[model samples]
Target: MDALDIVMNKDKAVPYYQPIISADKQEIEGYRVSGKVKGEGEKWIDLHPFFADNSIPDDYRQEIDDHIKQVAVSKYLHENRSELLFFSLNPNLVVPENIEQFIDRLSVFKSQGLPFEKMVIELKEHQFEGDVSNLKHFVQYIQSLQVKVALDDVGTSSTQLDEIALLQPDIIKVDLHAIGNSPFPSVLTEVLHSLSSLSRKIGASLLFQNIQEFTHLNYAWRHGARYYQGSYLSKESLTFLDKKSFTQALNKDFHRFLSFEKKKIKSQIALTDTLTKRLKNYLNNNKDFSDIDQVTKEIASVLSDYSFRVYICNEEGIQQSGNALKDEKGVWQYRVEERYRNWSWRPYFLENIVRLQYEQKGMLSDLYTDIHREERIRTYSYPLNDQLYVFADIPYSYLYEKDFLL
Candidate 1:
């Protein structure tokens, strides 16, 4: 079918269902409903716009005039939603001019009892190109309705992250493009797995799609995918019943995932405790210190990647020099503490550190901008046996160079 043929014909576009499974499988999580259209002698659905862009019919942009048809489509999905599972449809399929109309339709859905919550509207990664600010407002408005949003085809391009943060999607679907060759057997497992921790931090759920085999499903299950959709569950599958089956599978998968997650948290806590105690025992040896120098050496070595100079601010905001390194030997230069009121750091850490150091004696300090270095970094700090703060300068996420690069 030609591009013009699909738009003018309308009948050519059909809803193709893909199952969205929850690792917990209490019920069908949702249905990612994609539209199917025959490509020029190509059986594969033309999901993205770049395929033979030269051949696209000039008058029809995206083959779906969101400007007009969005209202009708919104009305259709809103009306037909099942309480058992969410019905996910595309938002960019709606024209920009018709966004208000779409909102109005959502209002009608709200009145009827469906609302956007049961109907997830996603935007195709390529379909969003205009003013993102306007798009954000539109998304925010939809969010106000309490309907969920998904950023379709994540990891397909660098822009996926931009849209993800801007749109604040509730779900980030892993793009099919990264799954091995568009033709070869899938082996891009490592790349797909990396996105899990990132997805978790943002409070977005990960879904692995375009998985054509059970092995791929296995990969997804092993790598933080809380949801899965593709042929292995059911080839060319499009039905509410498929949604139920997929959810059942996902529940079993997620049950195991929850167990694994708990175990990881436990292990991290145990190891952190062990490390803290060991550090304390080693530093407490009075023979090693005339002052804070011993603690400084260990901390500096642990955080050696960054060029560091430590400052201790006291109650008066004065840095006190303990003559810390006067006779202290090797590698202790990285940590030189002239005493400032050391308590300020702990109070600041207690008040500011997001994920680490909540009553834990030894943990990374909340990130603070290093006035000296003019960069953001966190100090891994623990109260030393001498009652002074022992801090190690470590770069964090904002300093991406420390992570993937170093």
Candidate 2:
């Protein structure tokens, strides 16, 4: 028998273990049983490529996902129902047709001695691309069984974001590859921010995986991620059957204390260096805010991630001139200085932006908005060092529909 036959025949191929630890408890809560493609470690990443080459039909998903429900969770629970557990299963979007089969089996396990509450069915990230309707029904049905669901590999793809919102999972497991390396990429940071917001909206927990060292754990901790599993953490088999090791792992590993201040100092200086380099490049080209209108127009495009608007302000909260946004219309008009020149638009000046730019010079103003734009738009302002350069982008609203400050 080749790989396919071996995969079907081998009990180990259908079930794998992931360690689950609590942020507050700081101990092994339980292990979730997940399905794995049979291969070397790196082969895990390229399993889909293998499937394609082997001419393995889409129908393989039914057998694979079914093997998960039958052999993985059922067998584990049969032997060790006394201990808590968490099982991460391949989502197998291809076999959504067998969703009812999956759910019924889980419900059967729930009815039996297995602790359904501890079973966490992880929908593997982006592997299966079958009917989403089957996937949705599967998730809802599992939740109905009191078996919690976790979106595994959350940082892997934004494609799952909407499904995450719609499904409202009990946990979101972050990928190991994302936060493991040095100089955590800005892209990952932005993605995590979006993931955190979505998690909050759904009242789901965040689980970060693959923390190679203390720094990775600290980063996740600061972001309010409560559940964790990683190497920096002491490893334990999260299995219920392995009573001796599991018992030992269940106890807290006291050494991992987080010093937020230290992390802050290190990260802040690094971030400052990054920002300074970026701002210096901006300063390098413009020399001064002479082309202030060009600067404001560019601000919207440059900081498209953050809604931007240009504002002019005097020492007090008095508004000198204000342009709150670069409209979608992209109209070319007066100076960033001109927005506030008409004192009647004085209402544009708000209490927030004043504190941000005041006393401190050449720093990013905290995000805010001009009250005059009916507070529909969010804004930020940077100080033009020269008083004559009275113009600067006030703030730009990111989404056109959400904020009218545009």
The candidate scoring highest on TM-score is: 2
**For candidate 1, lDDT tens digit of each residue in 279-380?**
666656533434444445554554444425443322332444332221223333532335444444544443523323345466644335555555566555
The 0-to-1 C-alpha lDDT of every candidate, in the order given, reads: 0.54, 0.56
Clashes of each: 15, 22
| lDDT of each residue in 1-406, candidate 2, tens digit only | 2446645654544555556666665555656555555455434321334333335654564455456556655666567645445654556532565566656666676776676776777776465566666667777777877788888777875556887787678888887564546546555665787788888988999998876676677667766786776666644332443334333333433233334455544543443344445444665676645555565555444544343454555545444544545455754344444443443344434443354456433343322334555333323344455242223333333334332222
Model 1 CA deviation exceeding 4 Å by range:
4-13, 23-26, 38-95, 100-117, 124-127, 140-148, 154-236, 255-270, 276-290, 294-381, 385-387, 391-406
Candidate 2 similarity to native, TM-score: 0.58
Count residue pairs with overlapping backbones in model 1.
15
